[model samples]
Target chain A: PDEGAMAQARELQGRLTKPAGSLGRLEELSIRLAGLARTCPPPPVDPAAVAVFAGDHGVHAQGVTPWPREVTAQMVHNFVTGGAVVNAFARQVGASVTVVDVGVAVELPPSPHLLDRKVREGTRDMTVETAMTRDEAIRAIEVGIEVADRLLDAGAHTLITGDMGIANTTPSAALIAAFTGADPGVVTGLGTGIDSETHHRKVEVIRAALALHRPSPQDPIGVLACVGGLEHAAITGFILRAAARRHPVILDGVIACSAALVAAAIAPESVTAMVAGHLSVEPGAAAALAHLDLSPLLDLGLRLGEGTGAVLALPIVASAVRALHEVATFDTAGVTDA
Target chain B: PDEGAMAQARELQGRLTKPAGSLGRLEELSIRLAGLARTCPPPPVDPAAVAVFAGDHGVHAQGVTPWPREVTAQMVHNFVTGGAVVNAFARQVGASVTVVDVGVAVELPPSPHLLDRKVREGTRDMTVETAMTRDEAIRAIEVGIEVADRLLDAGAHTLITGDMGIANTTPSAALIAAFTGADPGVVTGLGTGIDSETHHRKVEVIRAALALHRPSPQDPIGVLACVGGLEHAAITGFILRAAARRHPVILDGVIACSAALVAAAIAPESVTAMVAGHLSVEPGAAAALAHLDLSPLLDLGLRLGEGTGAVLALPIVASAVRALHEVATFDTAGVTDA
Candidate 1:
């Protein structure tokens, strides 16, 4: 954060037309953007980009979620063809969607918007063994960093975190438990409307995996190698790189937020780059945001993750910037203050 | 709400790619729109209009607020000149602004954007006598009805409620207490950051008005006549008119919510046309929303009135409609449902 720029923003807000602090969080957002952009009137949130990281979770072998692993590859195609809700939302918000094949079991055809950066076919079944090797984890994180570098180089102002993997929230919940020290039952949620039986089994699957790996929070990367999804590692790297570059990143749902936990543990300053877009209906999402001490911009109870919440929040982020840039000050408008 | 259109909307939401109920409140909002539009895919919330109802309160002389009553007329000028926060937000959201002078104490010149509909100079202080006569209150309501009709006839699909009256929340608090039966302190909030002494005095004034009037919630019009600002009266009638015309209405802070409570009390079905824009920092806003059984779309601790919060909500309301109209169904996208 740029202290000088932030101070300038705080001073500028005091001169706006309405009473001091009357705009509430909008005023706070402008100040935060000033620090990130290093400008009092920060740039608009667009041209924004949503990186939909596609991967297959080996835990699909367990019946944690009814969604088939093939759905991961299919959804990546949907994203490429602009057939997904995230695609609709991106168009509405004037954001571009990039599909990154981080780790998929199936072969995918190359496309203009697709980034071929597969670290592995997938991870081993986490309920029975470790998810991925440490080297593979590092490589996945590197892929995320590379994606951020490319997006920012292409003039994208903000990066929205997205993921497409069946049962991804299962690993997300386990990651949240490992990082935040929350009980499994407390943080675990039925990912896609699973029955009570499947939900209970999913909780046990996480407990078993935790017991087998005994992932340590001190070693965030090692913990990722043990229980995190490939997309999770990528998102963690994406968040870290965004912060390292002082760019704003909007986190989508539990998957991105759980990844944020690992990213924050690795570099505490990385959390500064993150913006909680909205509250997902999943329990782990709220717990993760609580641990991060970040308030979401919107809470429509949305749980569909493909960066829909983040894209939906793009206009709001832009509006906060526009308020600072466009609203007349009391001195300029000659409006009396209370 | 149109039951047939709403049923069709529910079926359409199920066909969307995401799992059932995963989109959460967004799906509910689309259904509400369908009911309002009487169509499965309702019209976009665009071509929306915000009615900035400016008025004055007799309680201003009682030092309920530090802002002079003349500021109300000054703000009407500000609204017309596009110098207010509401104008900035309206421009950002692609909405037109209409300033209605329902009861400004000061004389005003005409402008293309300003509507001169002063029912009286201002209402009498409720602590002294009834805030307004029954006939004046009815005329104020008629002004709101006319404004809604004109906006709707001009091709607006949504009407946003905005209030710009100095010390208006005084009447809003009193109206909330009368309708929701909440204690004065529980509902009364410091308007525009009043000093602690004035805050306590504001609470006592509300208590005194409630004791003197003992307004009946069942007789909502009588209650509005007893102690309500002209803007509040206008907004109540605006909401009622919108419901009758099957148009969507986005409500701002306590002033709008307080009027909404009166509107709902008069005709319970009128609540169907209303959308709680955001949770105001004012305590009374929450109690009124709870009593109305409407959850706010955003809760950014906003207390700034003049349609600021409602304009911020336009994109969100539009996104819900776009999802229904634009998102690909699972059958067409070849994506299996969860």
Candidate 2:
């Protein structure tokens, strides 16, 4: 990101026909985008690609969620058949959807939008052992980086994070607690609707994992390998790759936010390329976003993941840059300023 | 609105492939749209129409703002020439922009998108006398209703409110203060950037007008004639007519919010069709929206009216209904629920 371009964007915003700061957050978003593009007016954020990383969580065996582990494979089919909520939202925003099978237990047959990048069938139960070995974690991350490279090479102007994994929120809560040092209760919430008893058991499961592994925030990869889901590792890699390329990436709900924390810990500068798409209902999503110091673009109480929130915020991100490029300055339009 | 359709929409939302209530506010919004359209899954709110009601305020004599009154007429030209912010946003959402000159001070020639319906050159200075006679206020309200009818007849599924009137914020603050029974100081704010001293003076002006007219909230027309701008009255009519036809009307910034107060006052049921597009930086907008009991879809700090906030929110509103129509049910997708 270019600081000089940001300075130029701020100067340009002041000279636009509208009052200074009247556009509020949109003006700041545009300025940050200018820095990302290294230009006074960044190009439109369009033709976005949504990479939905599907995996299965071994924590489901511990009864953290009521949903069966097979639901993960079922959702992958739903996403491919364009019957999922994420598919509908992606269509609304004209963003291409690609499902990456990073760690689903089922052997998914080849499909048009499916990417077979299975590092393993499913993660190990963190209550008993690490979610994955260090090498397997790194391999899953590479899959994410490779998928991001493929999408960027295909001319996607932006990247949107999506994920589908049964009981994935259990790992997400553990990841957030490890990174932010927040209490397990503070970061854990009802995922896909859970009873009070289930929620309490989920929190204790996270606390037990943290007590056993003692993951350190300084070593992001170690922390990820200890408790993070396969999709979480992949999304972290996707965000890191996008940030390195100076392109913006829109993050979805709790799953994506937890991955973003990992990405930010690994490369502090990656936060510059990240956009918090929406404030999810999951309590951890807010804590992760607050720790990252990113304001979400929308707050519609959305709890569903799978990149739905990111796709919904695409127009707002595009409009911010479009205002910079399209609006006439006071001098250009010959309009008097206050 | 059909309660039966709303109930059916709720039933369908629970059966969506996603977990029940996972979509959060979007599910509620879809249900409301179903009631408004009298169908389980409402049609898309597309090919929308934005009617920017342009007027002038004689209250510019008060030195409440630094912007020249001529900016109002000049902005009308900017809108017609497709150089304004509203024009850029409307083009982004594929919505048509129509300028209705209900009360501009200047006599403008007709243009392709301009509707010549000037009720007067401008309202009288409220500090010296009533802004307009009761008859003129009624006529302006009638102008709003007629424009809404025309746009709805031309195949517009949704109506977005926009306004351009120099010094209109003074009257808007007064209208809000009168309708909400709030202190003038609490409702008045910097309109398009004003110094602290000017802001104080604006509050005093509103207080003085309220003191003089003693407008009653029950007599909605009297309140408009006493302390409201012509565009405010017209927007009130626009909201009323839209509600009568059971179509959604998205409200913009403080100007639109103040007018909404008047419309809701006249017919309490009109609140059913109103959608708060975004929370403006203006203090009165929040106060007015609170009085109307409507939650805004976006809170991006937009203060420049002209329907930019409403236009930005159109996609979110459309997607809410799209979810109901496109998302597969759990039984249909053959996915097990928790």
Candidate 3:
């Protein structure tokens, strides 16, 4: 992103009809987009694609949630069939969605929209063993980078991160605590309407894993290999790739935010490409986004994580950019500001 | 809205995949829309119309703001030509905009999209005399009701309130002070970048108007006739008509909020029909929303009042309704609770 273009965008904003800084963060966001696009007013961000990375968490065996592990694959099918909330939202905003089987435990049949990019069938239970081999973690990341590149090549100007892994928030909490140095209890949240007993067990399991692993925050991939889901690693890679390409990545929910913490650690500049789409109710999401200095566009108490938040934000994100190209300047309107 | 329909909507929400209250206010808004539509899932709130009420205030002679009074007519022309920020935003969200010259000081040459419903050529200086005769106030409100009915009859499922009167927020502040019983200095803002001295004078102007009128909180129209602009009176009628017809009315900025206070006082049930789109930095807007017990959808420090805030919120409001219609129930999706 160029400082020159950002300065030019701010100048243009000043010439609009409203008072200075009246548009607030939308003004800043539009300027940021201009800087990224290397133009005073960036090209329209259209033809958005949401990549829902599907995986399985071995931590489900710890009784962190009551949802069956197979529900992950079933919900992926729902996404494909355009029956999920994300599907409805994407349709409303005219964006497309794709599901990437990054590491789902089942060997599903091939589908047109489902990208088969499994690095491993599932991760090892973090309390028993490292979630994945370091090599497997790298493979998932490379898959994510490839996904971003392919989506861009196929004409997607904007990318959104989504994840599908039951009980994934357990490792998400641990990963955020390891990176942010927060206590497990502070970052842990009820993942999916868990009973009080299950919630306690979930937090304790994350604490046990962090104590057993002692993953270094400085070594992002090492942390992922030790206590992260494959989808998290891939989302980290996805965010990094978007930054490398100077494109925007709208992140959804706790898992994507945890992945962002890892991505930002590996490449501090990657946070520039990320837009916090919504502040998910999951406790770790706010902690992670706050550490990253990102404010979400929507906060609807949305707990669904299949890029639903990002999908809902598509029109808003696009409108902020669109105003740059479409709105009349005060000079053009023959109106003077106070 | 029917209580039976609201009860059915609540039951339907419980059957959805999320927990009972996981969606928070989005859930509440959806149920309200359902009750208004008399269905568990409301019909799509498509074909939204934003009525930008353009007028001029005679109070400009008092130097409440630095902008020229003719700028109101100029912005109306900007709106008619689809060149203003409101037009840009309305186009972005597939919503249409109409400029109602309810009391523009200048007579605009007829344009197809401009509603020439001028009740009078603005109003008298409120600090010196009544802003409008009681008969003129009622006429302006009736014009607003007609505008709402015409828009809805022309197939606009949702109505958004927009205002364009120079120095209008001055009267807005005075009216809010009269209704909410807040001090003039507390509710007054630099309407459009006034210096400290001008801001203080603006506060004094509102204070003088309130002291001279001593408007009753119980008689809402009396307040409008005393200190409100023609645009505010019309928007009040527009909101009341929408509520009577069971349509959602998205409110914008301090001027619209002030009008909504009038509407709510006249018909207390009208609050059910109102949706606060954004919280403007204008101190009076927050006070008005708080007094009305309404929470805004977005708060991006927006003070642009040509329906920009409400238009930016179109997609978000629509998605909340869409979720009720499209998201799969837990039993149908075969997904389990935590």
* Superior by DockQ: candidate 1 or candidate 3: 3
DockQ, ranked from best to worst: 2, 3, 1
The fnat of each candidate, in order, is: 0.66, 0.75, 0.66
For every prediction, compared with the true complex, DockQ reads 0.64, 0.78, 0.65
By TM-score: ranked, best first: 2, 3, 1
| Alpha-carbon deviation at B93 in model 3, angstroms | 1.2
Ranking by lDDT: 2, 1, 3
- Tens-place lDDT per residue, model 1, B119-231, is 99988899888999989999999999999999999999999999999999999999999988899999999778899999999999888888888899988888998889999
Chain A TM-scores of all predicted models? 0.98, 0.99, 0.98
**Candidate 3: where are CA atoms >4 Å away?**
none
Per-model TM values vs. the true structure:
0.95, 0.98, 0.98
Q: Alpha carbon lDDT of residue B199, candidate 3?
A: 93
Off by over 4 Å in 2: none
Residue lDDT tens for model 2, B1-338: 79999999999999989989998888988898889889988878886899999999988998889999988988888888888888888877678999999999999878978999999999999988999999999999999999999999999999999999989889999999999999999989898989999999999999888999999999999999999999999999999999999899999999999999999999998988898999998999999999998899999989899999999998888888888989998899988887
CAPRI classification of candidate 2: medium
Cα displacement (angstroms), candidate 1, residue A133, comes to 2.6
Tens digit of lDDT per residue, candidate 3, span A72-161? 887777777777777877877888888899999999778897899999888889999999999999999988899999898899989999
- Candidate 1 stretches greater than 4 Å from native: none
